[model samples]
Target: MFFWKIKKNPFDYLQKSFFFSCKPDVPSVNPFKTSKLISSYFKLGKIREAQKLFDEMTDKNVVSWSVVIHGYAINGFHSKSVELFSQMRILGFAPNSYTVVGVLVCARGLPDLVLGKSVHGVTVKSGFESNSVVGTALLGMYAECGNIFDSCKLFEGMKNPSIVSCNAMLAGYIDNELFEEGVLLFNRLRMSGFIPGESTMLTVVQGSVALESRIVAQSIHGLVVKLGLDSDMSVNNSILDLYSCCKDLDAAKKVFDMMECKDVISWTTMMGLLVNLEYAVDALNLFLKMKASKVNHDAVVIMNLVLACTVLGDLRRGRQVHSQAVICGIEYDLPLANSLITMYAKRGELQSSKTIFNQMTQKSLVSWTAIISGCLQNGHPREAMKLFMEVWVSENYSLDSALIVSALTASGVVAAFELCQQLHCYSLKAGFSHYRSVQNSVISAYANSGCMDFAQSVFEEMGCLQDLVSWNAIINGYGMNSQGEAALALYHKMRKSRGDIDRFTYSCILGACSHSGLITDGLMIFNEMVEENEVMPCQEHYGCIVDLLARAGCLSEASGFVDDCFEVMGPNALRALLSGCVLHGNVELAEVVAKKLFEQDPEESGHVVLLSNVYASVGRFQNAETLRTRMDKQRLMKNPGISSLGESSYDFG
Candidate 1:
């Protein structure tokens, strides 16, 4: 039944019947018709029929072997094609350039670099290394196998490398994210007086975005313009993508507007750019215009619209787009589905998000990541942890670095140190322990959970990949848990590393000094912040210094500092001083602070309490009583503090 299920080759059976019944020469009488029949069967994707005709041939040569190998390779049966190549070799057929290219492509699909290299040796022995077509295939095979070393070796050894070979190496570098190398080769190719083809242009444009090389990207753009390749739609689309990825939205829009016939991809790219730049209303208007003009909406367009709905916070319109996606039958697209999940999550509709996520027949890494992040962002940290754990348990779902990072964030909420340990182990097993994002998450998770030793260890291990966020996380963690000395040490280390410290890092270190009463270090950091770092002190930065002075019992100094900077003091800075007065029982400063606080927010009963308490401490009972009477008239009561039975009880309920 399995054999009969395949379409039968009628002519082959007839020819066999004729050879058996009447005469063998009858079949040999019409060679042209027989070859056409065999070719037709192969074209129809009837591989079994084609194989049956091959078996019926009294004698087979390189031509028959080429047909089967090319057919199998084209039909995606790469393993079978490689097997056929071996069989043809055993049959004493000389492998030509065509046969080698076909089998090289099949070898590229092996997913095993060792096997690909072994087959590459065969191509070298076959004397097809000098052939441009065969050389390109070999180079592509090495590149696709993730063996860029072998690819570069092959390219360098070539006596007269064609444009195809150069382009292949350039593309290989790009695929590996070696954008600088790709750009250099592109320049060399241009300087060597070799004109780039369409593929070469696309590769360079893509590499430009990958490397964020604006100058090289502009050079490519200029070349395209000068060569009149801008009119080509494919080249224009690539240029548009390059501009968008570079965050040059203005340039991207210029390219889009200049296109004579804008496709759905162009419009979608523009809409995405608008959404990224927070022009939600403009993005929505563009979507409406696209729909009004009857441009064909593909999966990408729907994904962009879903992202727009998420940004605009228009849940009503989000549902409409979801409905349109369902009606258009593009709802099954993973990216679109993921975008919908994110949209619902952003709107605080966890139930709707979960429902859509459950309905997906096809789930990808992105789809799973969306739902996991949605749970975390929408205040369902436990659910996020649950989904993340499930993802780790499944083998088909590769553990992405982002998934681990998101889970670490959720785990740190309850200080799930055990879960953090599991992620660390997973990172080691996946050989991504040094991944920057993963290492940052480990440091942050440890730091937030008060595991300072682990945080420091992770930070120390991060030799070079520590960006501003990593340093800020560790510094802020130390400040939060009252490790002022350690925080200051890290800030100095960051400065030594030539790291450009931002306001967050400074604010964190200043806060540490305020709480720990490090007056000298605080002053030094403050001076450096203003003069050396050249970071204009925000109100928060200034407030930290005032609070630090107040904590150190430098009341007159604090008051002088506040007076000197009264013009620059924001409302929060004034409140910080009022808090300092309450801490130090300074009724004189409290009196001046009360007037500022009351003017800032007359309804704040806490400031009244602060003023009354300050007055009571100074034996001015009548003033204190008058403050109480004003509080009664305002009808605002101070919030009483509540005590829990046990600290551990808070974790569960």
Candidate 2:
């Protein structure tokens, strides 16, 4: 009886033998033939016809009810199907495992977990819980309802779970972000000799993607080839995505190249990943290849293409993508609009950015963030702060960490110190202060506003939870305030605390020593940066050391260091040495430095003006006049020095 009941198809047994010998009240038509016709109508999407025929059935058995219920469920008439199941129960017709499975599908569709649990009770009451077909349906229903724990319990209670149940449970695990456990179950099932079908392999590949395990990805790749599913588009797309997630671009490209029938998903996946992995130019090339092919572009693909353009800083191509997006009819896409705003802002095309931003009928938080960041980037801090105030005042949109950080940056640039304090308090009230980014931004804002006492207070309140940025902010804050001794003390204290010091930390500390004329400490720190921190001195590091030595009237030693380490020392080091020459009345050495400067980059007029001024300071008016004539001939214009005249104004352009 158990083996016989395991047969899933309701009409297959009837074809072999008359399982339902119906007594036709109307003798002209056969009831069994009528039931088969109902199923055919349902399959053909003729639900009204199927239901009309079902209503005509006077002698309805369990098979009759199950067929109509299953038809209605599969045809997307879930509420009606569930109503029929309830009516069948009230009519005293006992539901078999097949009937239970049909109603279970409806329960999942309606997302009625209460109905599903009640059905589980009925399945148990009818002893149909042991049936594989019923068990798999129940497993799927529970998994669909986000009740994986109950699904797992139900599976364990089953006598012998089927492959369908296993697959359902694996999907459940993936849904709940339990990929480690899902992979383990897959391996156990694979080792137990259950040959996964195409869908199972696809799910396994998805789980491996989440795990980001190279071993699992490669293993699945081998299985795909071994099982001859390499040509399966869905499976191939998933495998391609998995390889990219694992950071194995070579493997991802290989899979993409080997795809027999690449689809839009394949192109989108590679396009997005290439852009994300900083291979923006390659992504653009891939988009060109995709355009050359038969596949048409979608909104997501266009957005990715825009992103590639943005990353490459190719404003011409970015505008072209914008044009093509309209031609493709996705100009109204919100993500594309936001991407365009960011692209234009980054490329210094603020007018184009604001046009896209203003035309947007509906703006997301990203929209606000992008435009505000653009304002700040283009030196329009007043505009950024005004927009930020609107969001804060209206309370229409909830501010996220990124948005708040942008606002904090704007406030630091132009807003008063009190405004920065208020933003900090608001962040704390809104519970965004816990985010490391927000905390760091607040600290930097306070430090930049020349409020080290507040910066130090915030840093101390963070206690042991302080990040590298926090330490750097406070340390650099001290240095900027001309409290060089305090900055050096904090640096030593940071070392004692075993805090990780990045290259920025060295830059800050060296700048502190440079400002205070602590030449010995600055030299020792630069040596330690190379020997202990193993940090290769970048241009900033070299510039800071040159500034330190030059400021201390050590022109000879500073010039020698420039000669020795000339490779890394670019314009910054040269500028620092030239400033030292002007400060110390060394016209001879300034001439040599100016010669090297012209050899490297002659276009810079400020350095040349400094050398001319040095000659003029020693009463060499002829040389100074000669230099000014040469400057005019070369059309070398230096930016006029600007002084800050409170907010919303600069003394000069």
Candidate 3:
């Protein structure tokens, strides 16, 4: 009757009236219910759909804003979450505890310490500083930004800190590598009736893993089961990882078996443990077991399997895993790809590595580093330099210290002075000069390039900051250039400042003495090495001394030294003596040294070449030719075995 009283359009009018009359101000779709829909959308990974629905909501409150912001945060749209957070504040909407947590997650994604501090100010202004949830979020944000000092100060200022805040602080400590302090805090908290949650257990497990403290790991493991937190998947996985990292495979296996539901991480951790113990074959077997259980293969699991094969020197198995990864359609995974590159490089399959690298559509910084290092490791220094320069040309990567160090090594080996200068300038520009490793590599590269002047400059720039490696590199550089006096002087300077010189330091100094014919200095240093006993004289140290004496025409003294430490010197000192014999025309001494080398190892080609030269040097063409023929038929020759020092470093060879 009401519809007929109006008109043809009256029915539509009546429908609207009836619809609005019942609910009046209440929306047909409840804002809270709409918020839930957005959350559901986010859960389904429909970020755009959720955000659109949130934008269209006209009846949104603080809770409504929180839902979408939190959705963005959880979905890794950190910048968008921050943008929404800023918009909400500008629009005069006050954020609640939930909003603070969501925005703080975004803050943690941002590396700028200042942004985190600004967020902290907002929390303080909002009077959420003492609120446990907000305090935890704030603490985590600072810690993630590497501002541990402020995180500590904020935590210490909190009164009646909740278990969540305590867990955050503990995790922060572990994340920043303050492992010992984290463990100590856990001990103190345990005495104060602080019951740990699953997150807390995970953090504690991390601390124990970092310290590799077997006792602490076992204790925590017992606690995890007793407290029933082992039911948490993350907790279970972390517990397994802890036992594995501590090298307690039996305990790790026990935890693995006890896990009611194991994920890919659990399998990876267990396999990693086996690999660490050099039981890589067992690790492969475990992988087969994992497959039979139908967990499905992931990129990480396959990558770890490849590493296991690489470690076992099972190149055949490695190839099988690589094929499987390709068949599984995860061959392009960055980590898996990087592992394969290293595996192939170590196995002398550099071409295969280069192929894989060329096929990658998008390369990560790690990808670039892996290929460059692989090239260098495979003894292709110029190739390494080529790839490194490609990284610069690509400009997609921000250089890390390790990658820079590798490039520097390649540049030095190729002895490209222009490239060296460029790398030094680039390092200074890129702020990598602050890294001691980079500085040391630069010095070594400069020295290797025969640029003692630039090497000296970098060494002097290091000043008091020069580490043991820096000292070694500089001293070796001086020796390489035949500036024996300079090398000896630098070694003395290093001795005054760094008294705890290791075997390498002594080796470098002795090498300098040997190069400069400072026989007395070499003997004094050798005696000092013996006297210190801190760093026992190794084979290289003894070889340097033998070379020092032999080069000074003291074959009798060098021969006596070799006899005195025959057990310790191995075959290297004999190789040096042979070279010295060639240098000083002592054929009889050279033949005796060659016989000693053959006795040590019958397969090394180094001393064979040296002795052949010695025979030819004394106008014995027939003797040299016989030795050369035996060298050509390496395996067939019974008496003449190759020595370890192939293509000897001494110029007399």
Candidate 4:
């Protein structure tokens, strides 16, 4: 056991080390070893090492050159690959199909159509154009280069196009947003007796999703199941996306449950779909399940979760998600930050919203719009206007339709006619005046700012391009301006021209009838809305009708209507009828309606104030004083009326 080992010869060890070290310089005539070494270097991703070995080779064959070229192309050295190909040709080495493909791959990576076209000339001169492999490579190169026209032409010229070639062309159409064309091409491919592969079906599914055609998407889904591609995770995810985007949540859920393995995208897609459909509880539950399953989430998932939490007013959950986003290092993600801002703002937490907005390093149009809209909604019109001014002066932000509409709304709220006109001029200069929402907002702003002529002019200019909103805006403008006859005339014109009348249109016309004291016309239109149009009357509609009858001195008819529709007639209708009672000195009716309103909502100071005013008007001083005492005991104060003097406004506080 204690035997000593014998040492090897020093020369033998040195010779073996030398032979292994100089192996890359193997005999030039024996090109196989050099090629193998180059290939091994490439396999290890040592592309430069592979190139150095090839450069040391005294006798380089096409195989040696191809290995280096392919290494360069696959390693993202696209230009170097092309340069090597040129050098190979200059050295009088003929490029085979593999070499041509390597060069074409370089072209595809470069996305250089000019170089790809020149390669096409080389393939033609070399008589490799007819080669199936070369032809497929050329097709993919051209397609990926965004030259679909040439790709299609090359595809047609192929003697027998393979499934790979067809899939390449389909991918090109889909990637270029030519979804309809992609779908049509898939159909044509089927007609040509080519079996569609997973890639082919995936492209078709994408096209259907883009077209938003549920029918077509279902058909493709059926085909996928028939072809047994339902097991493919990518295809399954695509189907999920298709169904989610089409708003077919039931079907999307079915697909998700059937999947044996669910990825993050699957869970995210489901969560996002539920959020969009207003199923906030279900979205949160699904998100919890995803977390339980240990699925990683990206910024998009966090953004959608914030929105869901906002919808549910779950501020605690929102803050938790905010913390998670911060830990994940995506709190600064622009879209997620924007969603956080919107969530906080919607929940009346403007301080938190502004804090998040201030921390954003980069803000998109949607970001600016969200904060500006939040300010406007939170009763901070001045802040909203200030933000708009910042957006206007920033070279980084461009004025969009939403920004313009929000600014116009702020202007209208403050009744700043000069600012509104300036915004209108800017819109015209910025070429956003023709946008439908912007146009609608401009009309409303002009009307609200006491410029009826401008409102009318904007409405007229819209002409046939006017939608239902446009019609509603102009008609409401006329009604609010007390030009009720003009509003009625426009309603008649809208009825004659537009067939798809909405509830807003009817509401506007009914308001005009109430303002103008057109009782008969109002009754006729109300009947048409309920009976002919089949638009169920809401509380606003009922209030308008009651106001119309009451304002016309038809107290009995108004009372009868209120009694007939008492269950559906909300407090607004009761208040309208009560005002009519007060105006016409109908004390019995006033007492009945006031009691009903008090029983409905005792906290509404308007109701108490109206009843007190009625008692005061009739010299019932004791009753009025008693009501005032009750209001003081309840600590309820009525908002004062605002009046306008020449160039100034005052509130009777």
Candidate 5:
């Protein structure tokens, strides 16, 4: 019967139709009959049914024992399999090569390596140690049990360690986060002329990603194609993961688009790439596309969708995804709820975020941090501080690094310098004052709270020096205080330092250049960034560049630069360009940019006002009136002009 037709490969699953050909009394037959039927049931993942028949067997042989052992081992019941192995031994049924492999797999979950060593002894006594299948199994068991030393020892002792054994060791090193060791092992495997298969490629990619070695990742990708392993799903997914983790969204997309067969994991990975890249709209569209393709969306995809909606500030989409989360029974899952609240808060919907926060049955530190951070983002610093204090009083919660950072950020908002100092002392006691992110936040908090002296002191005490973000925080702090020359000096020192210059650093430096009207210096830094720094200019950088050029009265140069730097045109760039044209009274250029800005974001009232200001500055009263009339007709209110609000008091407020 067609139902009885089984694929010759042992790895293949039994056909569903084969149930029709199964005899009703098959379980009551002889030992061979029971073993075959049990093996079939085991292969189909009917573990309980297989276990019932095995329990009924009056005279079980080694084959029947091996079958049950393998079923338990493969199904992740490692302890039960090991216990059954002892039972088989008591019954005087010696384990064969396959049974030895099964027993080794079962020994993985054992805490002590003694059981695994005993299994190794059994394999040797059974003369199955020489079998490559059993050898790989033993190697994998040692690796999984964190006995890397023993695993490598086993591989070295083998007359010929197969590619499977090599891949297992490589994967073990990666899982242990010994990236350098994994890379070296992979190199040694290549030198030994044992061709790396897809699994090896995946292991190497995992190592590269963990190390954040983009060059190594790219090389591994090349090796994948060179070795013809790119078609392997595991290899492709690893490549995708590496690119996403590296923040190389373009590279990730290239790998994603190159895949001929995209599984749900692949789709989820692509969605993750979009989220990490901050292409939330595109990510949501891709997720909808995945659903349209009939691919099952897992929890990861759902989380990505929630993130995308949050970014787009599309409360409607967020609510739709929330409904889906309810259907999936994860809506109130603490992490998911925390994420939803964060998204809503970022979109300025503090009410919805607060409601969700209040509804959580169980709250983690993440939940508290999310709601507190949301309050900070939604301009409720007092509310944020209240929540932070509540979290502090609740002894059930632990203050993680993120929680402290958010509290410090809120402290900066309220200019609660004394509270910030207390938090700083707490951070020191917690030993997180030395943590990079925590230290960076401390510096930013001190700088923003007008505690420049404290900020400088913290900056000087950082043992590992400063990262790009630290430098940015200091430079931006200096810029905020109108200390342009000081900011410029810091920028020069940063450029001279051997630190990486991210977009934030470039953006800060440009702000300094704009403030100081350092046209020559700004152009120099911009050129250096594009040429030497190789930090791709995003909208922030482009805005800074345009502002610097415009402040120097080079409106035409700034306009031309904007046209060229049109890859990721954002509101800031348009504002800078329009402001520059208005400052110079370049009516033609202002008209062009304002029209484009209005077209792109008509709801933003600043563009029309900039055009009106340009017209008025150029003595084009008629044009100014015309623009005003247009604004009135469109019900667009001009943004308030820069306030010369006097600091009557030298207080922090």
Candidate 6:
């Protein structure tokens, strides 16, 4: 016992074992055991282990080969699976229906169609093409590969296809965005007396949603209910989504309430519908109810909640939602984070918005545009321009029309003329100048930057591509630049064209009349807008009319107009009259308009200043000083006027 025994090698011990000892004499166990282990490994997602075991097998049967091939295909290793299928065939192992299906699965994801074609050839050679299951798989593979032509041929060749096969083809059409084809096929299936399954009906409903046909959607809903498929959560959700897309909020809510077991998707879809319909308050209240019901809030729900808070401008609630977003661990989600930035910026909390933007690890073009637009809106145009430059220098971001528009706006605000021209050049080079929105933004930027000539040139170049916005922008530019004649001419031309004149169009022309003292033209156009164009005059139109009359030395007529429309006129109308009074030295009317303005908004120091200036212009210095004293007593401070040069310097006092 004390003697040192010789160390036995594990290899020798394995050789003496029952399996290896009978090697070459008995049937080999390695192939069978190894194949089973490979299948188990494949099931457990140990793909490398399965592959290694499969490679070591000396005799692979069709079953073992099919396992590896199917496993690789389904697991998204499509190329590796296709290679194994070829190896199996090279080994002279005849293919079965299962093998053919596995190969077809591999073919579904092949970027190169040649391999799929080869697999198809093998299926035909193996005489497994007649198998319904195999045929369906082939049809699906062709569809998934975007070979609709081949898929259609394969589908037509199938004699008396099963419902599953028909659904596969139908789904292919829908997935390819061939909604009309899908609808035609659905009708044919119905005519053939084929009762569609949940999948088939879902596809049809999707087609209906894409078509945005309310009648078709309603018919599909009725069919779903008749088929007793409305109870299915997926079908119900699809119905709800269809109604939401069509803006049928009542029908969507009805479908939502009918759902027996509402999932998170159901709740989120309903909340999104409310938000989309501009019922922000209702959306927030529903979200609170959802929280009270112990339903979990996902990123989508949080984003909706943030949007609601943004719309309401409820900073307290917005902050609460931000905290909840952090707790949910989705605060860093790009879209949700971008939404948070928008919420804070809209609330006038630029510091908080910047903090959120800085904390983002990954920023999208939309994210950049959101913060830049926020900066511009919050009166930080210089900062916004700087951010735009940073975005431009970064190669990771591509400039979209939205970002371009935002940057152009910032450039206009800062009076960065050179920068504006550079952006215009870049837009042309990037091929974004052709985009109607970008073109409009460029026009507005040039006009706001005191380049009406460039703005007009862009407008004239738009030709037939010019939309209503283009006309409005150029007309407004002319009005702002005191080119009232040009503005009126453009308005007349727009009227002659196919462009439908809107309220904004009328407002711009009226503004031109006010600036150029075209009282008769203003009154005539106002009548045309109402009677001919059927455009209802809004508060702005009323203000324009009052200004037009006041500027034309018809102070009495302006006052009478104001009295006539006093019920509908806001402070802006009175303020417009006050401005005209200041211009024409009508102190008496100025006093009346200022008093009305004060009653409307007590804190508006501009109205006080304007009236004081009118008094000073009329040599009533004592009255002007008295007004200044009253302003001091009330602690009202006039907002500083901002003027900018071509560079970054701005004068503010």
For model 1, residues 142-247, the per-residue Cα lDDT tens digits are 8888889889888988888887888889988998888888888788778878888788898888888886656666778899998888988889998888887777
- Candidate closest to the true structure, highest TM-score: 6
Model 4: which ten-residue window has the lowest total lDDT?
1-10
**Pairwise TM-score winner, candidates 2 and 5:** 2
lDDT of 6: 0.87
Q: In candidate 6, what residue range of length 10 has the lowest lDDT sum?
A: 1-10
lDDT of 2 by residue, 315-375 (tens): 9999999999888778869999999999999999998899998998999999999999999
Each candidate structure's TM-score, on Cα atoms with residue i matched to residue i, is: 0.73, 0.73, 0.70, 0.75, 0.62, 0.81
lDDT of 6 by residue, 373-404 (tens): 99987988888988999989989987998999
Cα RMSD of predicted structure 2: 11.8
What's model 3's TM-score? 0.70
Residue 51, candidate 1: Cα error in Å is: 3.6
**How high is the lDDT of residue 493 in model 2?**
95
Q: Give each prediction's root-mean-square deviation over alpha carbons.
A: 8.9, 11.8, 7.8, 7.0, 13.4, 5.1
Q: List the candidate 5 regions with Cα displacement exceeding 4 Å.
A: 1-47, 60-70, 85-100, 110-114, 121-128, 211-218, 226-237, 249-254, 284-299, 320-338, 357-368, 381-400, 410-434, 444-457, 468-653
Please report the TM-score between candidate 2 and the true structure.
0.73
lDDT of 6 at 64: 88
Name the better of 3 and 6 by TM-score.
6
**How far out, in Å, is residue 459 in model 4?**
4.1
Model 6: residues >4 Å from true position, as ranges? 1-37, 40-62, 79-107, 114-135, 288-293, 398-401, 411-436, 449-467, 496-501, 527-536, 549-568, 574-653
Query: For candidate 4, what is the lDDT?
Result: 0.87
Tens-digit lDDT string for candidate 4 (1-653)? 21221144556665676766677753335788888888888778897788788888888899888888887888888999999999999999998877888999999998899988988998999999999889989988988888889989998887788888888888878888898999989989888887887778777788789888889878889989998999999999999999988999889999999999999889989999999999999998998899899988899889889989998999999999999999999998998999999999998999899998998888899998999989987877767888998989889877888899999998876677888899999889999867999999999999887788999999999877699999999998888777888998999998898788878888898988898888888899999888885588989999999999988889899999999999998999999998887787777788899999999999888878778778888989799899989999999988765444543545675
